[model samples]
Target: MGCLENLNYEILAKNCSFKETRDIVKRMCKERYEIPPGFKIVGKGVVGIPPIHVGIREEKLVCTYTKPCHGTFVILVDSPEDIEQVRKNGKPVK
Candidate 1:
């Protein structure tokens, strides 16, 4: 089985490194989404686009994922306001 096949989304959200998440996003994500106002960017997979892996909006966890032959996707997962790992590791916009 592939690495992603075994990877758990909740664990990935809580513990994976930025490099690991970025790699996954790059391979799967083919599209991007708009970052709404006041959201803090936690991880960006690729350049020049709206797609990202993690973010904080209104005290929630926003994550991006992709499905084979289905297209890239974004979602808001329930989480505490202080997931320090994701918050600290994210590459913020300049």
Candidate 2:
């Protein structure tokens, strides 16, 4: 796994829209990454589900807005090993 300090990344604004996040990923992430269809950063939450979601998709870090009232955001991880850090804190998508 690559060290966190070794990975180049930025935590996008919480107000960033899902579309904006996707666009950023496409433009920034240089690896084969996927943001699942219907992926939402902020929306109606399930009782047991978290309002904020974080995970790794295709080696890239993907996350939702931190609060229900906020919008989505993005974190650009530089290595596939970075996936481990995400999984430690959240679940993985299919």
Candidate 3:
């Protein structure tokens, strides 16, 4: 398996629709990586704050919005390795 296989990712956002977030990520993967079918969103609504869902596809970890919150936020990570890279790069996850 690739290094990114079965990775986990977290999504942080405010005031956003889950469906909209999922659609946006689907579009991005299709346009940029030519990923077919796209990632699968799993899990139920999270209590407090916005609901967050988790799933995996083609070794890429994906998190999606399930509840609405203020402000818009989005993020993507290939693997735990990539998470570190994102942190090291000083890119805000929120």
Candidate 4:
């Protein structure tokens, strides 16, 4: 199953608030990309923000967003391979 689909959203929702979830996602991105968590890319102005939301589905964390200037952003991945799959499918990665 997909990472996001395997996530336990119920547990994540109960243990972490929306803000906390966003923070964790940002941190993960920061660590992965070696940049600041809120750094802007492709004119998005940040990896997580307004129109950009983060949440947990099943037992995985999910990040999605839409930007007036950059179009849309939707990424659902658990590992680097999944990320590559999403990109190969022409979807955003975050």
Per-model TM-score on C-alpha atoms: 0.39, 0.40, 0.30, 0.27
| Candidate with the greatest TM-score versus the true structure | 2
Superpose all Cα atoms of candidate 2 onto the true structure and report the RMSD in Å to 1 decimal.
8.9
Over 4 Å off, model 2: 1-10, 35-66, 77-94
- Point out the higher-scoring one by lDDT: 2 or 3: 2
- lDDT: which candidate is best? 2
For TM-score, candidate 3 versus 4, the one ahead is 3
Question: Where does candidate 1 have its weakest 10-residue lDDT segment?
Answer: 41-50
Candidate 1 global lDDT: 0.42
Model 3, residue pairs in steric clash: 14-69, 14-70, 15-69, 15-70
Cα deviation in Å at residue 32, candidate 1? 14
Give residue 14's lDDT in candidate 4 (0 to 100): 25
Q: Distance (Å) between predicted and true CA of 27, model 3? A: 0.6
Residue pairs clashing, model 1 = none
Model 2: per-residue Cα lDDT over 1-94, one tens digit each: 1343455655755577666654554454443233333432222221112233444445666443333566554654445543554444343333
TM-score of 4: 0.27
Question: How does candidate 2 fare on TM-score?
Answer: 0.40
For every candidate in turn, the CA RMSD to the true structure comes to 11.6, 8.9, 12.2, 10.5
What is the per-residue lDDT of model 1 for residues 3-59, given as tens digits with 9 covering 90 to 100?
Answer: 323333342232334355545544443332333323442332322234344555555
Native RMSD of candidate 4 (Å): 10.5
